[model samples]
Target: MTATDGHGLRADAARNYERIVVAAGQAFEEAGSAVTLEEVARRAGVGVATVYRRFRNREQLIRAVFQHIVAAEIEPAMAVETDDPWRDLVSSLEATVEVLAGRKVVLAIARETRALDLESMRRFVATMDRPLRRAAEAGVVRPELVARDLAAVTIMALATVHPRDPGGADRKRYLALLIDGLRPAPTVLPPPSTPDVHGV
Candidate 1:
C-alpha cells in the first residue's frame, strides 16, 4: 500500500518524515516559499533522495510541513482555557499568529489557498466562526463582525508584526489593538429572533 494508506510508515520512515517536516518548517520560516529541498534534507540529516521519496515535489513537502506544525502548535493552544468567549477568541488568534510567523509553509498555504486542497482550512474557519458568532451575540465581540472579518484582522495583525520580532512589544501592541477592536459596541445588533420549533 502507499503511504496514503492506513498501513502506517515504518519506524525508520516515520523518523525521517518527522525530521524532514521539522527542518522544512524552520527553513521555510527563514527563507519563505523559496526554501530549497536540499537544505531541508541537509538539516534533517537525511539525503535529498529520501526527501524526494517521501514528497515528490516542493508543494507536497510544504503542505506536509504545515500540517505537522499546525498539529504541534495550533491544536494544543486551543485546548487551553476558553471560559470567556472574548478571551478565547483573542487567544486563538494570537496562537495562529505565532504559528504562522514561524512556519512559512503556512504562509505559502495562505497565499495559495486555491491550489492547496486543504480541508483543515475549512474546518478551522468553521470552528472559529461558531465561537465568534456566539461572542457577538453575547456582546463580547462586535455584532457587525463576521468570521471572515476576524480572519482578515488576524492577517493584518500578522503582517504588522514581523516574524523575526515575534513576542516583541510591537506584536503585543498589535494583538491588544485587535482584541480591542473586536469588543462589542452597545448599539450594534438588532433584536434577537425566537427559535422556530416547527418546520416552515
Candidate 2:
C-alpha cells in the first residue's frame, strides 16, 4: 500500500490501527522478532483480526512499526538548528543513536533481514549528503570527506557502542570520539617570498 486510506478507516478502526502499531513497536523492541501478533493485539486492547486487517504480515507490521517510530523520533531531530555544520551532524548522529538505543526492535529487524545491502546503504548515505555538504562548505567538517565515509564511520561507531549489552556511557563516549574526528582541521599555507628584481 502506497498510502494509508485515512478516509476509509472509521474512527474506531483508525484508533485500533494506531494502538496496534504502537503496541507492536514496544513488543518487538522488548521481545525481538519472536514476539507474537496475538500478543500485540492483546497489548493494544484489540482483536487479532483487527491487527491482521491493518498489517497483512509480520514483515509489513515490523516495517510500519519502524516507520511510525522514526516519524516520532528521528524526524523531529532532523529539524535541529546549528550554525556549525559539524555540530549539527554530531547532534543528528546523537539523536539517531538515542533512537536506536531506545528502539531495539529496529535493530532486531536489521539483524533479522540483514538489511544493510549496498543499495540501501547508499540511499542511507545519500540522505546525509546534503547536511554533510553544508557542514563541509561551512568549514565545520572536512571538505575532502564524503557522506559515504561518514556513514561508514557512524555505522562502525554504533556497532562498538551498541553491544548486545550496551550502556549509556559507552554510547556517549564513542559518539563523542567519532564526532571529534569528523571535525575539520585547520588549513596551512606556505609563506610567500619577495618578488625577483628586474635585470639591468
lDDT accuracy of residue 167 in candidate 1: 58
Per-residue C-alpha lDDT of model 2 across residues 94-193, encoded as one tens digit per residue: 8867776787656668557654334444445555677777787888776666666566566666666545555677768887887777776786324323
Candidate 1, residue 162: Cα displacement in angstroms equals: 3.9
Candidate 2 — what's its lDDT? 0.69
What lDDT score is found at residue 53 in candidate 1?
93
**Candidate 2: pairs in clash:** none
Q: Model 1 clash pairs?
A: none
lDDT by residue (tens digit), candidate 1, 47-133: 999999998887787667656655777656655555687777778788877666555445665457432434555434444576676
Score each candidate by Cα lDDT: 0.68, 0.69
Cα lDDT for residue 113, model 2? 68
Off by over 4 Å in 1: 1-12, 31-34, 104-120, 123-139, 143-146, 163-167, 187-200
- Candidate with top TM-score is 2
Per-residue error (Å), model 2, residue 127: 5.1
lDDT for residue 33 in candidate 1, whole number 0-100: 65
